[model samples]
Target: MADLHVESTVQDNTDHSPQNNEDVQKCHVVVPTTGMKFESEDEIYSFYNNYAYQMGFGVRISSKRKKPHKTYYALGCHKRGVYESKAESSKQSKSCKTDCPAKISVIVDYDGTCAISCVSLEHNHALSPKKSRFQRSHKKIDSYSKRRLELNDSAGIPLAKIFHSLVVEAEGYENLAFGERDCRNYIAKARQLRLGKGDAEALRDYFVRMQKRSTNFFYVIDMDDEGRLKNVFWADARSRAAYQLFGDVVFFDSTYLTNKYNMPFAPFVGVNHHGQFMLFGCGLVSREDTETYVWLLKSWLECMDGHAPKAIITYQCRAIQGAVAHVFPDSLHRLCLWHIMKKVPEKLGKLNQYKAIKKTLKSLVYESIQSQEFEDGWSQMIKEYALDKNDWLCSLFDDRKRWVPLYVKVIFWAGMSTTQRSEGMNAFFDDYVNSKTSLRQFVEQYDNALKSKKEKETKADFDSLNASYKLMTGFHFEKQFQASYTNAMFKLVQIELQCMLFCNHSLLKTHGTISTFNVTDILRGKRGELKRKVVYTVSFDEVGRDIQCSCHLFEFRGIICRHMMKILIEKDVKEIPSCYILSRWRKDLKHRHYHVINCYEDLKSGGHAKQFEQLCSSFYEVAHIANSQEKYDYLLKCIALAKEKLSDDSSWSVNTNTNTISQDAHIVSEPKKPLLPPAQVRSKGHPPTKRKESKIEQVTKKKRKINVHEANGISSVNDNIYRRSYDFDLNH
Candidate 1:
């Protein structure tokens, strides 16, 4: 049966006069009589609906009859019928129905006009005119309000704020006809319409459209055997192109819950020349197994043109470790130093001398400049602290090569010792996306985050070009770096040059063209006392002007160490060699990817809208160029020829590959049926629980330092925690 509820908008057309004029039309005092005539059934409903609205009741069609010449309709109160109970309902709910006899019968005469034949005017329940706006039949969202809500939503305003604005516009809650829930429901349906068919299909269409805009845009969709989306990876052209330059050391972390589907957000992060975090690529994976990690890594490698990074840093996950080994065999796999250090207090916090043990461990990990030094210190500390029986310590010692700073200092890490770059990237994206963000919305917000990051990079580039830093030292080497390196990198070089004052060196030995010198660094420690003199051996070849330091600061980081600077000054070298100045840190390098336009600019309205935008852009450019008469004539001819060439009657064939998009990302046509959205599953850990803060952060959050107090020959917990956290900063 069709819905019996008749919704008619009530317009206020009050006729005010001392006496009622027969010619004045009345709407609020509509009365149903036995001989009332109407133009059609619609007019009858409008008249009764207005009366019901004014009387604070609802009207509906109680019955209808149709037979050639004898057609009639019966209207009554909405709650005029008896309520029936259903056993199938799990819970009982209140119904508004009551056996009210108030009704009117309208009959269609032979002339096709409707007239009231019967009337009964009596109601069973009381009604309030002020509360009538809340009734289901009377509530409505007008076109102006809907457009305003949509505009606010598109501008990223919160729904609560939108509803508040609407309420304010209507003067009060009673003045507004619709409620917040109604507005929310309407917006939800509007979003559904925008995401045509389904969210997965909308995502696929977005990927295809982006790829069409830029061929360098790459995306891969991994589907399960059931054709459901399992994992997705994508990188814009700018990111892909950036990988060619800064992909030597990468930070990959998958700790963030990125979407409503509970997929892990894994981003491959790198550092650009300006020491800014750069996104190489990112992916969303449903699983954290070795197979899933392997596929994600492989897809990223393909997107970066199969040029594996020299080093990759990540948290200590067994699955990721195995995947990194399998997919990037030649790449140096290093565990994040911060991840291991943050667990120090948790793993060994119960020890009686926990502060002493933490201090010794930090000194062993960070102060040791050589692999043998770290090994010897680690063994001595374990034996001194009697920690040989601790399983966690044993496991960490066994995997020392993957996290120990002294063990992995052979390769350049862009001056990074941990995966904090990935953490910083995640912090940046936290402002735009959340756990409830949909896949399509995630991509759109991801573009916004990239734009914000790029704007910073652009500003940094501008600063590098226009700003200049004064040289702290008068050395020719400092002057040379000031001219060659960026302002940021040059400041680092100047710091090293300034530290040469504290570096005292003496000639050790000479062999052929190689001269060795022992340099002692004397600097104030964190406690404000002179630190113990640490000796470093510097080897300099006069013939090649080559220098090497035992500290390996230059080998691990790109900057030349103070020890080398001391030796260079002693040798009377006027300027540093060009080989020591890395091109990655230079200010004059030209960026090639800046020419590519942003991929998400025209993505809000996908498909034909993008095509229309491109045509509009092309025409605008043509019009701009056709200012002169001769150029205008040439453009007219070109337009005619282009139109003729595109006037083909042949059908355009679209590729319908749904499982995987190629690395080149040839446009994959949207499927006739959209695949179902990925099923929700718990992430790697408890989804609802917030991540616990490490002991160091929690303890030091309120105060950076606390005086140690002895109570019954025991130190306070906060004092011990603060001291241990102090060691973390000292190491850094």
Candidate 2:
């Protein structure tokens, strides 16, 4: 069949009237004419595809001929072909052919310039401008869209949101050249390109590059018998350094499956002095067995200079418990109280008086101030509620020592009794990764997330230095902490100080250095009108200047409780004992690891960068002190003399511009071959599955299933809940 060709240009020389001007304007919609020219063949295809998009049809290269001197091409409607039937045994294919006979012919001259010789603007079938952008040839991801998609995908934005954002930017879906599928395909291709060798190889290459740039960047890879990657662990210098300062307690969790290989993301998280989550280490493991966890914990411990946290919190997992016992025997292993309590409804919801039982259980667990009190309350509740037959409850009781706050209050936990910090860390990571992410992309996004976290910590550090809070109690102790602790920690102490208003303490007895007092505290319940009165015992020591509260808030959280504060004020104690002021939470303490640069930092000067920063700090202090002109001039002279002396010493020469190791060069010398990606493994817990569609998706799918607008005199129900309820009442 021969393709039909039409003139691309429509000229109206006699168009002097308004209607004629409108027609001329309508005709000039950027369509290619018979004499249109292009710089290259790609441009020719692009122009025709654009025209096809505007004309509401798809275009394709129908025919092409190439010779030594000339090249010929014919671009036609995708439907301009004869249809052929195939056997049922063959793979099913959808054909869109109706012999449209619409085409444009182009010729490339000796100079390599393409000029349109013939053009067609007609199609045999009906053309819908709204659907043209969906055409195969017309749908192409432009460079701008590609970059935007990549960035949004890296930031863990869903496809629907990405598509909606693009559609909004383009005004409407009809105005967009590419659809959601094209965006998805482009991102998939980008991932493939990013993983040049493979996912495992690319990740190793990235780790190698990072390690070379930052010597303190640590990573360890575990391989299966077949040498395939089984698990991987890594910790940057900042995280390692942070662990040294905030390593008293840690939260370990591995519930999130954030990669294609289905490896769980395990992060060793801790609370910094500022009460922000500090990542100690991270790992991706195929198995959740005790062996795998032991390896991860040992690797993390080694990275952090073999310092095991005093207490570790985790979800209820036997594998983790066993691993902790093996690697950190002396460390207290506490299960996540939140995770255990979250299962209350599932385990006991069907029982009679379930609400009462749940309320009593909560009071029994949280309100108890001592271990014996909790044990007594638990026994009473189990018998009162007839829960003796509940195996889950029995198991929980067996493990109560690990999760119950009163049992663990004697140990320092940085005020955390649950693994919520780890959960928070996981939530933070959700902004950078999703289930469909590949291992390579996960590693890359990890760096981005870490950099963002570092930026937040730096901002917090700056704020702590320049900001201060109003003293609530006007006590010397409050002033002492306000001057020493970070702003976040000071706020916590201020909370205790303010609570002192509700506390009334009286001397019960005195024993030489120790005087026991009974303290009564009035606290408000969550219900607005409810108030509770509780009595606590406080012991004060005049020799040591120490006051211990029976509430044990100071022992557990490193903050003085209201009872202790009240007793101290009664004793006329003007200053807090240095023993009570924890250096771990102090603002002025600095760790060497804080100076260790991460892979994201500038590495041109290598190890000298840390020295440069130290020198800059010293110079800044000197500059701050030299307020007078005479002192400033003398300081400048001293700096000049030091510089001269340093320059004259040949052995002290250091180049600040270049290092022996190029930042971009690959330094890994092992594996001689690219490593194979880890096989998709079935991790512990529920098997990995696609994320459940959101409520918006469910509504959209429902709308798609039944178009109410097109139904016979049918309409969708009122979407507003209040309106729906009102309408229901009216109908009733």
Candidate 3:
């Protein structure tokens, strides 16, 4: 048992007088004093213990022996009561001097009893109940929980459900971890139905669905710091899927995402003619080094289900070329003219020269240019520029010829020249993905963007058919052309024939056709030239025995000269060759019925008729404005107005040349005896009398002066010509 004791005593050491006798009696043992009295040690100790306990304090009392007959009481207790009592007294003193406006009472019911509570003089209110502080705080927590529960119920979604949906849409369902929202939702749903607490098989099935769905959500993985591809494993999977769906002929190109110190290499791949970007493969490289190119190609090839591509179209880069040659040896490689054009200035120096170089390089692709011409041009260019004359350039030029006719036809008919399809797709990627984006996000966004663009393009193509058909047979053509006959026109026709032949030959080769027709024959028959008129020229130059015609058709149009046509005609060709018709021009005649008669009607029918109408209107307006006759009339009106304005300005004068006759000059007199000599001569057998000593020199001089005056008059017509230069300068 714990020890418990209380003791108290008081010391008295003074002689008392008779008046103090009453106080002594009041202090006597067992005496009850109504007002106040000295208490014995036992009573004092008991009172202190009770007060200490009430005040939440403990007290100990000790009896001290100060004298033989008297004892002293020493009390020790917590200072809480003393401090609290002093504080109360101080508060009371302050309250007593100040008066509040009105008495305020608060009623409280405790244990079925009513109590009126009022502000005390010592303080604003009674001591605060310790329970009240905790109760107030507890109410706030309860309110918060109640509001949260209400929100959850109204939304009809647990916090876990919302979070799981987000994660499923983000990282995918299969990758959800134990604490992930999806997992929690699955568990909660399962338990709420009184199902088993743990179902490993169900959990596995959920993850499998998530993983399967993740494929639909594409992702691009960039390279890690160690030069390994980071998250883009999906690219490999996607490439395989694409290959399975569509056979090879993938167009690939690389572009930078940012100018930051650390940047990812974005390599994109697209299907052949569909212009669909199947995937964007990205990786980090220290620099665009040879190893990086090799790895990129290898990774892409691997992602392509380890199957060799039939062909790869990309920009011309040495590293890329080398890598392709090494890795995709079987793949026919082609360069994107869009990128090549952008890159040429850096290699050749000077942008202005690009036009000329492009034109020259473009001719290499024309099949009409004989192998001999290509070789000659290649040699000359190499010699002029001191290039290496490598076999690679030769092969490049050779391969370009195979596609040149298609490119020309597409440009002429479809009006699509550059690889803007790829460029536009890349621009879309830049908009959707930024530097800080993770590989996973880039993949999803790129896939979405690609899918969207493809759908848009399909719709656009459908809508564009109307405009394209109109453009193929529009009035603008007639307005733009004037009747003219020139040897150049015939020369161009012959060249066009040769180009057709080249294209047809390529098609024949590609399609394995049995029929063969040369372009030269058709050209000759169309030009009304006989076979005998064809002439072959031999030169010591690279072309050797190649034929040349007076028209120089081959030189101008990079085609077979008309002479070749006459020779081909002598061979007696029958069918029109396929190459003569460009694919762009050779549209399916079946679709001709769909031509839009009215643009508004076509638009109402949901097509690109409105755009087509606007384009046609613009073309017609420009053509009309460019009419020569109208321009000439406008010029004449302007000239008349200018003359009127000049007449109005009195200070303005037309300068005229001054002419004067010199009166100081006189003619010398001649001898008059010349007539007598003429008569003498007549007397002597003279038909010779005609000599007649005439003043012929003076007459000749006069005639010369008259001619000079006439010449001056003729020269005055050129005065306007001189004025033209001044006029031009002023106008400028």
Q: Which candidate has the highest TM-score of all?
A: 2
| TM-score of candidate 1 on Cα atoms, chains taken together | 0.71
Q: Is candidate 1 or candidate 2 better by TM-score?
A: 2
Deviation from native of the Cα of residue 647 in model 1, angstroms:
35
Q: Please give each candidate's TM-score.
A: 0.71, 0.76, 0.34
Superposed on all Cα atoms, model 3 deviates from the true structure by an RMSD in Å of: 43.1
The root-mean-square deviation over C-alpha atoms between each candidate and the true structure, in angstroms, is 11.5, 12.9, 43.1
Q: Going through the candidates in order, what is the number of backbone clashes in each?
A: 0, 0, 9
Itemize residue pairs with steric clashes in candidate 2: none
Model 1's lDDT to the true fold? 0.76
In the range 537-640, model 2's lDDT, one tens digit per residue, is 99888898867777777777888887888888888899877989998878887766568777662222346745755676787798899999999999989989
TM-score of 3: 0.34
| Residue-level lDDT tens digits of model 3 in 369-454 | 34566567766766655556545455555555323332222112111222323343344454455444333233334444544554
Model 3 lDDT-worst window of ten = 723-732
Off by over 4 Å in 1: 1-158, 161-179, 197-199, 349-356, 419-422, 468-533, 539-545, 562-574, 601-603, 606-674, 679-732
Give the lDDT of residue 584 in candidate 1.
85
**How high a TM-score does candidate 2 get?**
0.76
Residue 439, model 2, lDDT: 80
| Per-residue lDDT over 277-352 for candidate 1, one digit per residue giving the tens place of the 0 to 100 score | 8898899998888999999999998998889999999887788999999999999989887777777877788999
